[model samples]
Target: MILFKKKPWKLVTITSTLIFIIFVVLVMASIIIQISNYKFDKSQAKRNEYIISTSLLNSGLSFEVAKGDINGIESIINDYLSYKEIHAIEVRKLTREVIYRKQKTINKELRIVAKTYSLLSQYDEISIDGLDKVENKEVKTIAKVVITFSSNYMNKKITQQALFTGGLLFIAVMITIFFLYLFNRYIYKYLNNIINTMNSIKQGDNITLKNKGIYRVEELNAIYRSLQELSETIYKRDAQLKDSLNQAMEAKILAQEAEQFKEDFIRAISHDIKTPVGVIINLISMIVEQSDTIKDNPSLSEKVNACYESSIVLKEIMTELFNFEEFEQQKLIENKTKVNLNEIFSQIKSLYETKFSEKGLGFSVYKGSQQTTQLLYYINIDKGKLLLVLENLLDNALKFTESGAISITWIVKKDSLLIQIKDSGIGIPEDKYKVIFNKHIQLNNISTSTHQGRGLGLFYVKRIIDLLGAEITLSSKVDIGSVFKINIPITSTMSTNTENTLLLTEELSKSNFKALIIDDDQHTCFTLTEMLNKYGIETASENIPEIGLSQMTKESFDLAFIDFHMPNLSGDVIMKKLTSTLPKNTTFYVCITAESSPYHLEKLDTLFHEVLEKPFDITDLQAVLQKALKSKRVTNEVINNIKGKS
Candidate 1:
């Protein structure tokens, strides 16, 4: 049998048990008191017997003996001795003889017995007095009065009191136990609820105790109120923090848009500058190539060659700057696809072979010895950007190497592709190797006469490789050679064909198509119209979206180039209006602007036939125009067939 270990049960049981024990002890105490009272009652009865017998013997018998009236003495003794509590009584004269004696039970020295205790007789001596005579104060005992009490006289009464006390004790214990049980259920249990709730909350158990009945205690109510306030405070602070973070994010996005605009302006200016500089450089090249006409003066021819090279160098710097801007700003999104390393290398080899031949340097490409025969040199990547990086490295190798060979080695590992472009040219100094990749950095040992680039080639290469999520390392010695290694992580080992990006199609391959240009900028609209006219495409221009849309609604074109950021109406809204009202055959939609956010672009992709980013070249423009023409033709065919069936 286990005693209660829980607090409520323990309190109830201990209290109830203690009350019961106290009741039992009190009952026992009461019994002892009753027994003591019995003894006192017996003593009192003995005292009464002594007084009564002495009075009767002294007054009644003494007077009678003096007056010679023995009848009265005998009557008093007989009357007193008739009491039941008086066990025996005796009256003796001065002669030591029993003059009057009465006995309920025979005994020499009287003893009375109750159920569990005994009582002895009491004796008292009485003095005799003469009737109407002088009192003898010094006289000895004349008569004796003796009395004994029956101890069993009040035994039944005492036993009844003990029984009554036991009954009261039992009732009290029961009532106390009832109150203890009630305290456990009503008070202690709820207290336990509070304690248990606190413990549970301390352990991070989410719960709520309704203060409906639980808040009966004022102190507990105060505690609960404080807890609620604390939780509310924390929640409010958390909400404020979240709101602050959201505001910060919005500010960052706005700042990003501002930066994006600046980069877009840079891109447009670079493209505009590149086209004219390219023409200048080409005209200078023509002058150099046809220098025989001017060979009458070799000094002038040499100066013209210098001007051509300077023009060419200027064009190269502009192109490199534009590429660096694109990479740095992440404006050029990578269009990744499956590619064959062998094919990409072949193209790179062909491109570098021309440069190498011009420079009279040897160049070759091969798989590294570490590459396994079982492995496939297939990787998914942005083929154009990857080619750009290889081109830059190979170009650098050509520039540095005068007569030595440049070798490109690649190894297809299980997880990555390792490519190294090693040159037997003037190697970089050990300390300058890392800094060689920095923008505008030139080595001391490299030839100064043929360094046409502005030292941005390696920097641009590194940034482009970073955009590819690849790693590049350079190893070089002062006079030996430099090895530039690039590691590209492989996503899959499955064999794949090289990706071909041929955006021109038959429908719009020719430049004799009609097009509409819509933009807010007058210069941009005019420039685009001029460019399209140069391509032999009949072009219309509108600087406002409303006018552009109105023009489109009135007169149909083969393709409509709408700017996304217009005055009142956005490009997407225009697409929606056109999609709803305009016949699919009449015009094909094209988004042509600098909206480069992925979210906006993805949304536009669903609406436009194609997205033509701003600052694109003639080739990019041709590709988008071709797509637009193809869609327009397809839509027209579908409608014509539908009309024919109808």
Candidate 2:
């Protein structure tokens, strides 16, 4: 077999070729031997004929012929003819006279003739008869003999020898070929098996060769044993790796579960802490709002204001703590609502105007051109997150600035809002701009300032900006001022008059607008009732959701404030039951919650018409009332339109 034609150095091919050449040589040698033997046999037969003729002359056969003794010649010839090879013999004198002749019948075509000549002479005796003696004897030709030999015997002998040699050579060659075939098959079988095993290994099969018998060749057997050992080692290693991987996966699941438990614990603690904190802050805020009563006592007002400020700060710290954990976990929920930039701007102005004046710093807000103001800047955005980002930036500015002016400028472009907060304070280095946005990173030069913080303000701002898909860049020089420019992409916009036309007058108080407050916390119910009563809206408070539901069924209220978490029934469950039976578009349901968890808040957002986070002041309450009033007006308008059509 031609295993590899390109590489002729293979052992089997070389050996087979050599054997074939040897076989051809042996065949040629046999033919040469046959030819040489045939010639040798023919030559031997000619030599025998010559010897016979010469012996006759030596025995004086030629003299016998001269004496006319034909019988003697005939007897000698007859003796020679007794041999089978000599077919015929003839004797004649020198003058061509036949002395004696003998022949045997043989195949004429199978006979070969040979000729022999003999000379005869007589020597004179010295003195026995006293005759003349001659020193030199006279030589004379007496007779010649011709013999015919049969070639058939020589031909048969040569053929038999040739046939014998050829038969032996053929047998030897066949035996050699058979042996070579066995050797080739044996080598190929093991070699192919080794190659197949290697290929299987390459294909990721752990094939064990232990069951296969050892090879006769020591080298091949050793390699096979090594392969078996390697396969076993690989299998063991794979099992170990799989076990390790399974353990690692189990550990990872445990770690995730622990992390979830930690998050839940933090959320539960925040809820418990924030509920009372919200109540305290709101109650203090109401006390602080009673300015007429406290204005006469400066000492009392100052202490109350200090307490109010401290509580506000504590609330802010708690909020930041919760926000940090939520942002770290990437679990901050985004709730987008239609908001007015003017209102947000007004809030910011109200919050920071007094603080900046106390610091002996100039504060100014530029709201762009008159045309920009005329177009209602109503945009869909997460209002709380945006406020957080702005507050962080402004707080950072207020903290860093000593006595310089701080200015805020905002403008509306085609489909985006751009705001810039510029502060004439200690500026940041160019290299530190990007680094300052990382959590817990601060400028080293400014680390000793009295207003130094945990370095979370800008980081929080960056996280909120990124969450809102907005862009903020800072430009600053040392000892100069810094300007932070922010560009927020607006997904949607509206151009309309967003002014609140609802006026709170005696007519509105007599309008018979009623609101329901359902909360498991009596303090929250009382707070909400007091806030609603200020708007001249009649309020009924229920601590139990079941009682609230029963009250709701008996009387229809224009507005209902429901707490998210309750003992018997949750806010969502109550809302679901009431929404089915209550008149649609008549009652506005608001969910009040102290829980800061995004999961719970997201669920409540889906179930409630409005979600009011706790710790809100009169401004927040006023906003909710305005919305309820707007909704009631729309419902009344729709009803009147239907009645008129009918």
Candidate 3:
């Protein structure tokens, strides 16, 4: 009852009230009809007295005889047998209300009448005074009837009516219950669907109400539709919020990338500047301080050597920074040239020989056997950019190798040259090997007191190798050692070595040679002309390409130097045009570049007698001039020999 079963209670209440009310009406109708029929039978028996009295008179039977005459009544009853129930009759004399004389008899059928009421006095022939008459007493005569009849038909009629009414009520109750059951099923089904849908929503599932037209209950379907609308609204709101969150996350990521870019830029600028300043300071200190032990005022040549060495180191760092950005952006174009492995490796060894010896660490370089790798021939490459890559590797090795040996070895594999830089140092962990080439990835534990790398060296190596369509790999174990390997595809070769250049400082000051210097920078041209004059070479210079070309064609010069970069027409185009027009001229062509062109140096060597990088030492300039003079001498000798043979 506490649960308040509303539907079931309503079904029972309504059906029971109606069926019972109908039951009461039907039962009361049967009872009233039965009672009325009994009364009618009683009145019908009472009315039969009049008929009997008249029948007795017609039959010549006296009233006096009916009181005591059984045979006479029998004769009368036989004559008037129409009164089937005239079993007996009594005529009684009463004084006011007292009975005086009373008689009773049986009919011819021997049926006796039994009266129901008691008389106050009975018939007494012997009274209080022995049959004496009483004065002032009035006497009257009355008859009584004793009637009995069968009520089988009346009872049977009432019984049939009750049965019929009860049957109708029973049918009505059953039909009500059946319809109620059907209604209950509909209500249960609708509620069950709603409950299941609510559960799904509560469980965080997306839901939609469907097939509602099939349900018969309009209100329930309306509620269901409203629920469906509500669910859709919630889902739409949730989706919008989720999208907003994702956009926020993307914005955060972009901001982080910008910050990282800024940091990388600052780090690059500082790292590039630091190494060169240290080298310059150290070089100057060595020249000034150590010269006192050499018994000489530091010669111009010594100071120049110091400046050139510092410049070479500074140029290398800057080039690495440029290549780093270029490679990362995939903007570094390929400039393939024949690279003499022997010459480049010899230069690297010489460059690091003093440092290694000072550190008391051994450095060795090896070339693979002829059967293993073709190391003796010139391989194609971008010498200048690749030079930075090797420099980075060597610097890393130098920073890590304190005591044990460092080795640079190369073997020609099928389709590629595999170069390995191995070092015995505080090695990297094996797990960190994969990420070691990622920029900013570094190890704290190493050979040096302070590790000087910004962790971008290997990253630059990886990118450069990838640009060259090659691969790089690393292997290491903590406290053991590490080996970094680079696989470079072999490039096609085109040319051989050029004239040998040697430093001729004293010769440069004593001799006079006419030279033409063409450069885009006016200051650069001025500096070159002044320096060449100091070296006893007569020089004419021009920053404009047209003027320089005119001077070159007009005058038969012994030597000409041109800067590769200019405002509009590049030095390469100017040189090709000038040399083509003056094919037979004895003037030597030289390319003066601000950066190393090791990448294309071999091809450039075939084009120009010599290549000079900017911020040149006096010695390098003398070497270029000496090479030019030597080639002229050799050419004159070959010409004379050819003329004699002819």
Candidate 4:
């Protein structure tokens, strides 16, 4: 029944149909033979009856009738009628008078008769004693014998035989058909299972032949075994592939972690080196700043200036190394804020002015025209990136320019700000303009004398300008000069209000502003203390953080300088402690560190009121002092306001 619901297989359907048709044909032929035998039996029965009557006439019944012996004829008829097939018998005279008659009460409708006439003439046997000769002559009819036989029984027997044979044939045909159906269904089941298993394998299913010996056919069983082997192979291969993939993933994770550790180590070492380098540069600059004492000794002054310049160069080399690492690591993230272009330009000018002077080159920064200056040069920008760009360009200009001037000129327009750094240096060839900005490219024709460059300054500048979404262009003529112009798109602008500059006066110096310095390095503390003492400000220094925190608790210093990296406690932890314990806005906390990475600076910015990068010269010191004094003044004014309101 379940097999019937499925679509029939073409081979099975066609073969079964042919077998059924053949069976039907055979059954029909058998029926035809039975029917023919029945007809033949009926005809044979009639012929046999005729032969029996003729035999009785020849066996003296005819003579008996000729002699008028009716009893003898009756006896012969009676003897024949004893047969079941014979129903009646009779003898009649030549004049048609019944001589002897015997009949049984049989169904007349089913009876058939055979009649024979007996001759009255006798045969003559002639004489030559040993040889008898019979003479044949035509004899007239004297008596007739008729025999009736019932055909009903013969017909019934023939019919029963035919029915029995046909019944057996029919049963044989049905059994043949049933077995054929079962054979077809068995083959169909195995073939269907094979097809389903193949399809499962094609779909990437993990198929197994559960009943391996179920397929009786040798070929089908062979195919099943092969499929089982293939499935097992695929399962093993997949497992191996999965294990390899997992191992590869683990190795990749370890590689990334190692790379991270490498970068961290490099950053840490670079920062550590920068602090001491900064101190040396600053201390040398301070010594050089005392021009009066050194002016008398030309040789000593020359040596001192040379040392300062060499230290400055060393510092620059370290800076370039750090910048290279940063670029390689792609650590520059854009952090835009409102910045005054004027102040940024002023700082760059101040930073490079002395260096340009020492190299006998005129340096100046022009903040556009008077009208442009009054209109505020404030705009939204990434200040650190812009500083890097301007500083790198200026450094390049200073390196190449021997005698003439280097100037930075900027002007604020309606939608954009245009900055141009012009230098009277050996100009670049027009063909080399684009390639000059490529990494590790330098002009071999131009002599850079004692100023060695790593050829990455312009590359850094171009990358930073691209990051800022600003466009930079270069125009140059050979040996005439080169001018780099930067056009920055400004989305918004703001104006700055004028504020009274904090003047360092004798009265302010005498104002007993005690400062606290917390640092693990005694050299840094001593330098800072000396600088503050010169300003008439009393200062105390602590080499340990715990001692520093205790000192802060005992005294309420107006200003504090904290070193960022200490052994016992880090600068941020100290700041956090101070913020939690100390009064709000009491001490103006300044964070001093050599770490210039953006992440560390950003974190320090949140904790400290001001972050002062290490190797501070007199100017950086003065700036911190001025900002601290301004903050203290604001705090005092706020307190006075609160008292007045109360």
Cα lDDT of model 2 by residue, 182-289, tens digit: 767876888898899888776657787853433344456777888878767777787788899999999999999999898878767776667677777777777777
Poorest 10 consecutive residues by lDDT, candidate 1 = 114-123
Leading candidate by lDDT: 2
**Candidate 2 stretches greater than 4 Å from native:** 1-212, 332-334, 338-342, 353-362, 369-380, 413-415, 447-452, 490-511, 580-585, 595-602
lDDT of 2 at 368: 77
Could you tell me the TM-score of candidate 4? Answer: 0.60
Question: What does the lDDT read for residue 608 in candidate 2?
Answer: 77
Show the colliding residue pairs in model 4.
none
lDDT of 1 by residue, 180-246 (tens): 6875576676667767766765554555556764334445456666665655565567678779999
Off by over 4 Å in 4: 1-211, 214-240, 243-247, 328-330, 333-367, 371-384, 395-407, 412-417, 423-455, 466-469, 475-482, 489-512, 533-536, 583-585, 615-623
Q: Judge candidate 4 at residue 197 and give its lDDT.
A: 82
Q: Positional deviation of 629 in candidate 1, in angstroms?
A: 4.3
lDDT order of candidates, best first? 2, 4, 1, 3
> Global CA lDDT of candidate 1, please?
0.66
Cα lDDT of all candidates, in order? Answer: 0.66, 0.77, 0.63, 0.76
User: Candidate 2 clashing pairs?
Assistant: none
Q: List where candidate 1 sits over 4 angstroms from the true fold.
A: 1-168, 171-511, 632-646
The residue-by-residue lDDT of candidate 4 on 1-646, one tens digit each, is 1133433442343445566779778787978888998898788776766566545645667678768776776787777877666777777777778778787775745646455556445544344332455546774566666666676667887889888988887787787779668767876887899899888876667887975434334455567789888877877787787799899999999989988887788767765786777677767776777567786889999888778777876776676777777777777666665566767787788678889998999999887564354544567787667877888899999888888999988887787888999999988999998899999888878635666777899999988888778899999998899999999887656554442123463434756688999999888888788778767788999999999988888788988999988998988998888878875648889998876677887898888888777656665676577677778788889999999999
In candidate 2, position 619 carries an lDDT of 53
State the displacement of the C-alpha of residue 308, model 4, in Å, after optimal TM-score superposition: 2.0
